[model samples]
Target: MNALAPNLIAFGRVLRRAGLPVGPAEALGAAEALGHVPFSDREAFRAALRATMVHRRDHFEVFDAAFDLFWRNPDLPIRPPDPDEQPPDTFPAATRRASEAMLGASQPRSSAGEPERRQDAALTVSDNELLQSLDFEAMSAEQLSEAKREIRRLVLPLSERPTRRFRSDTTGPRIDLRATLRGSMRLGGEIASIARRRQITRPPPLVLLCDVSGSMARYAQILLHFMHAVANDRARVHSFVFGTRLTNITRALRNRDPEVAFQAVSHILPDWSGGTRIGEALDRFNRLWARRVLGQGAVVLLITDGLDRSGAEGLSEAAERLSHSCRRLIWLNPLLRFAGFQPRAAGIRALLPHVHEHRQVHNLNSLRALVATLSADGRSHRRSA
Candidate 1:
């Protein structure tokens, strides 16, 4: 029983490394709770560990896996001591080292006996590829910080789209008569090589309309980080956030540093986590900012949950107009993470038909999907949002 407390503490640390929120306080509480439950009772022990440590629904599996690994070892190296014998400090450095191994943090031990720490190993895995699929909202604080770094590293594969405007090219399909005549004159009036012109290509403009309503609060922060990365990566990215009204934050996101940019955004937005008015917000956008940003074959990304407080009043007409104004309208909803999701909401149904594509935006995996979609050359289909 004397040894149990220290082992439990190390177990809690292992859980923390496994992405659970268990910290020092919870570990102390679990140690105290073990005094009440019978030591011989396995179910009670498991119940006490779970009740004190696990918090969110998404974290339950992670906690369970950690518990199974930490507590259920059949061949634990240290055998129980004789009742007359006692060890100093209950659990020694060895058990904690074993806990680190069970948690997959099996790094080299330092001269002082603790596992050697790396500078930024908050959620370090043997293979870093797994982090790409980890859900952003489920990430712990240290993991979130690491994810912010990864977010900045993300590259946009924005393909250059062709424009109607033409430029002179020798291999072009269309003949440039003026250039042909000029070339002949330069060659002393003799008939010379034909001059040709090809259509000019430019990256299509990206217009982002993000929702900052209460329903979208969990994802809005990370989404803003993503928006900032994309905005700074290229030119012609117009950014706006909507709650009860539309507020353009393109200039705010233009700042290279996220901390500085979000500070400016917080100051600019009067309703950061307010009620949704999708229909009215789109109406406002169409009336004011549509013409300026939606030119030259712009692509629109509408990031929202589509739960309008106004019940989508006049939203269909507004969405139709927006579709016509932009070359492609892609709806990115975090709520689509649910496998059983349906577009039953009046707002979603109204806006669905107008969007060229509807996609999820819950995690890094989903964000990668959006980048992949953009990189593809096929025409985006008109579909449900």
Candidate 2:
């Protein structure tokens, strides 16, 4: 075994704790890769480990921070400093979480071979507050996990629409002649209590069309958790994801457990992280699903960065049709997180005019804004009715 083998193994555990998805095989491979590179060349050693352990682009920042902290003191094992010893603002949220994960994973060992310190430092209340405004794309794995829990608590209330069906109510505007006759029959063939009824009301259906192309992959994963929560929270909620093709994951997301639901979604989606074809995907939905799911005044949520690989071919027509079919068509773009964002993209320009509202959805606060927008829209609708 290489002299550095044990250290490499320990480093993998820290990465996993910090949410990098590193495993024993990756650690062994990294150790072997390190042997070929000169230990004196820090950059080469870091690159070797990174190439072997890091798989996703979003994970790069977390891996780098973990590497720096784990290898800071080579002579000693990885032991993060006390949270009070270092100001939380000094490091980025990702780095702070990485440090916390490291501190929790391995404790300091004494020269006298005393038992290791088992203290764990947790993120403070201020850190949780900061996470609400943090962009989903910039979040580390651990932070994303925390964010998912928060997302599950989000409520999406819809506007109630009256239906043709009626239910009994004492102060109802319309008299129920059939019910009145039945009551009279039971009252010794004499006139009895008059029955009244009112039209039934229910929340409108919600349909989500999310983009899962390479550009939107980071946002898509987190939003899926949000979608799962919404799906389980209400009835008549439909979810679909599109990249090069459109996939209906409504049934998959209906699973009560978010993790299990995501697993089912991953197994079925064929175009995940693939190229985008917004026009084609939208066209398909309008043709195949609009009539079926858009009935009864469903509200449609179109979530995408609007970067169509097809250069907006047929996008305008599809967007117009989709907007006409739904009660309200809301466009949510993560690109809106940028202050200088413009509708310069062909897809963005094609879809903008057809949407009822355009909003940003890159952070927890933005999501809360979405909830508020829907609630306010519901109230306004009630007043208009």
Candidate 3:
């Protein structure tokens, strides 16, 4: 066995503890890479670590945290310097001050006795990326709370472009030629009255169906904020949460502030994190709210992993009904981020046939993709089903 294999195993175990799924194969790969790395140079070591460790976006987060904690050096008491030992170099005063600012600590007074002012470049360079090693499922209560904040900041705002339609008024370029000809008969060829067209602008309605089952609890809080933004701004937005039951929380999310809206939703939703019944929930939505909310050009976002505990019959019935009513039915499954994912489950197979678009919603990058999907022209939208 190689000497570095043990150290690599230790690192992999640390990552596993930090909520990553690093296995023995990944550890062995890291160990093998160590043989090619020039550990004498700090930059070379860092480069090798980066190249050998991260396999996926999610892995990057855990690897970063383990690297920081594993490499951090605690201050030691002053002693007589050994000839063979290399002394730690003094970090620049500016760098030290910047580090203090990044930690939200008070900076020490300068040599002139005045407090050091923060510079934008200094602050930007000093800021260490926090979410790089954070696993959403493994974060502590405080870390989770901070993660939520970061998620909110990273969420790309959806662009609401007014879709053009054939309108009869006084300004539109798409001429109502049939109407114009009908009016021409009244003037007996002596006068021609041009029919005018005017465009009516209305923001597209956003209909979000969130899965609030036990499996989805990890993502519910953060995704609720994105739903809130859509609900509050768009006049015809509808929001619903489903587990064993379907609960409409459009009014709750319409509150001006997201915190207040989430609180209201929590009060209203009885099954926030319970057993999943995708079919029954869909059935209720189809029977009760379909016609009311699915009119005009409404886009439906179905947020779930298609894990139907209520059987495929119910899920299919509901999904088929919902798909027919809406202009587009987009299925957002976080499980697509996995390398070897397939719609092999009965629930997923049933639900997949009804969804117009199958999209991922696992991380920041995925969330940004969702914003792009929403803003994209409906005409250009692809249908997988």
Candidate 4:
């Protein structure tokens, strides 16, 4: 038996506790692989252990975390974090707690104000990265709660559009003759620098049409929270929920408290978690609220699973009209999360041709990607498609 066999076994057990499936057989294999590699080469040792132990790509991060936790600086005593420092934001409750415990264990109370500190940047960094990559459907209750917190902090920075209004600017292309003369009055009516005016720019209005039907319940529920967060964070975010009927929840989501806002939404929307009527819902929107909210170059986010109870009747015409009304029509479908997903449904097929962009929105990562897509252009405005 190798002298380090016991240590390798212990490490494998630690990995199992950390959510990786490392058994005794895998531990034995890892120990054997390590024996062939130079023990002095840390990278070689890690690679050998990883190849034998980790079965999935997602397992790599957990294994790396475990390896770092167990093998880190044997000579140096662990130092606990200072009492004043706030705990870092991390995800997947288990990993977060473990990191905080480890960091806190590294130090003991000291009489001096200055406590020795060593930054565990990698652990904190990897924890967040891992959390983002995790599927929302696979998250535990605790992880889901954590993910919600991250979503609350999320921002939707949409591209700005030029307004008919103008603001006085020193570097503007158009000279303001009236303001220039007014400024010159201070210097004996001689124009020192030309006063200029530029067209005012503001973010395009964001209109979200979310599906809250039976097939889209989970994703739609999370997205409601997301929309509420965005609505409260910024102006011009119009939110609506649709099932068999269209219900505008823009005013409902305006409250400072999310729970209160959600309750308000529930009171207003009666057909949630029911059958979907995407075409009829879009038809209602076009007839009643389209001109009201879709003005000022709005970007429409049509969120749904595209499962229509009406078999997509008038879906194409309604979809095309909605697409034409909005600056950019993005269809965010949770169904797109599947690898082999196809637009086989009548509603999906009917709506696909009209949308400017079709993307997934099943998790925080996808939501973040939505923000990225909207904010891709640094310019204030891009011509609407």
> Among these predicted structures, which one has the highest TM-score?
2
Q: By lDDT, who's the top model here? A: 2
lDDT of 1: 0.78
**Candidate 4 C-alpha lDDT tens digits along 341-373:** 977888888898888888888878899998888
Model 4 TM-score, 2 decimals: 0.63
After superposition of all CA atoms, the RMSD between model 1 and the true structure is 13.2
Task: Show model 1 residue runs off by greater than 4 Å.
Answer: 1-111, 114-130, 186-189
Residue range with the least summed lDDT across 10 consecutive positions in model 2: 376-385
Q: Estimated TM-score per prediction? A: 0.67, 0.73, 0.59, 0.63
Error of 1 at 305 (Å): 0.5
Model 2 regions lying over 4 Å from their true place:
1-12, 20-125, 187-190, 378-385
Q: Report the lDDT tens digits of candidate 1 across residue range 1-385.
A: 6778778877876776654557888888888788889979988998888877765333344566556656786235333345467542253322332334453543435588667776886876743476677666655445555777878888776678888889988899999998888889977987669889999998889999999887786578678889999999988999999999899999999999776687688778877677999999999999999999998888899999889889899999999999999988999988888889999999989888888998998878798889888877767777663
Considering only N, C-alpha and C atoms within 3 Å, which residue pairs clash in candidate 1?
352-385
- The 10-residue segment of model 1 with minimum total lDDT is 88-97
Q: How many residue pairs clash in each candidate?
A: 1, 0, 8, 5
* Candidate 2: tens digits of C-alpha lDDT, residues 178-266: 99998999888787688999999998889999998988987887898889999999999999999999999999998897656776887
Report the lDDT of model 2 for residue 382. Answer: 15
lDDT of every predicted structure (CA atoms): 0.78, 0.84, 0.66, 0.78
Angstrom error of the Cα, residue 364, model 4: value is 1.5
